[model samples]
Target: MAHTVTDRKKLLNRVKRIKGQSIALENTLENEPDCMAVLQQVAAIKGAVNGLMKEVLEGHLREHLGAEDLSKDQRLEEVEQVISILKSYLK
Candidate 1:
């Protein structure tokens, strides 16, 4: 995950936006907003989080799985780890 250090700023910005969106959602709830507005805010937050997950997952795949220096066992371990996380995420 150290590879993420290279894109830490960009990742932090995304996280900041997500936090803002969450606050907006909370405000909408507090104000007794329309259902459609609440749903839209929820969707935006989900999409933002999914985008972040995709970026990190891609980096992990390219840097860890695609490395030529990994042994067979190491490669299998990486694949298994990815699979386990993906399963949890998908659920």
Candidate 2:
């Protein structure tokens, strides 16, 4: 979406941070860190990913479903797409 272009940099930064956390988790695993340390790393990665997903989902809702220029059919299609994705993501 064109609106996403404006957010591309911010999104990329989040992705980069997630990548760093993943690398740290990998290193922690390799070094035989304590169970709690590994668990904390895993939780940090999950939280970062969830935050990214939340941001992207909010953007999609605002840009696709809340746009005023879209037709009724278009809005319905977007809603269905969102529902399908949510189903898959939640599962």
Candidate 3:
């Protein structure tokens, strides 16, 4: 699927933010920060990553899957694919 330059920029920004969070986490560990503080940072990074995934998934569903006309089996396949992705992410 084609994406506009703006869309690419947005994704790049999200990636940069995630990268920063990861570096912060590393620094926290190296500095021997409080355990709770490190855990909180880890949780925040996980939440951010999940949010990014959700955005990408929603865009794919709307712009690609939703644009297609398919048989019941095909639609079911798409749903299954999405479910599998969700399961993997949750794991």
Best by lDDT: 1
* Weakest lDDT window of 10 consecutive positions for candidate 2: 1-10
lDDT of 3 by residue, 1-91 (tens): 4543447888788888899999999999999699998999899899889878977888878765686677778878888998999999889
Residue-level error in angstroms, candidate 2, position 66: 0.7
Ranking by lDDT: 1, 2, 3
- Model 2 sits at a Cα RMSD from the real structure of 0.9
RMSD of each: 0.7, 0.9, 2.1
**Candidate 3 TM-score to native:** 0.82
TM-score of 2: 0.94
Off by over 4 Å in 1: none
Tens-place lDDT digits, model 1, residues 3-67: 69998999999999999999999999999799999999999999999999999999999999999
Task: Give Cα distance to truth, residue 91, candidate 2, Å.
Answer: 1.7
Task: Please give the ranking of all candidate structures by TM-score, highest first, separated by commas.
Answer: 1, 2, 3
CA-lDDT, candidates in order: 0.96, 0.92, 0.83
The residue pairs in collision within model 2 are: none
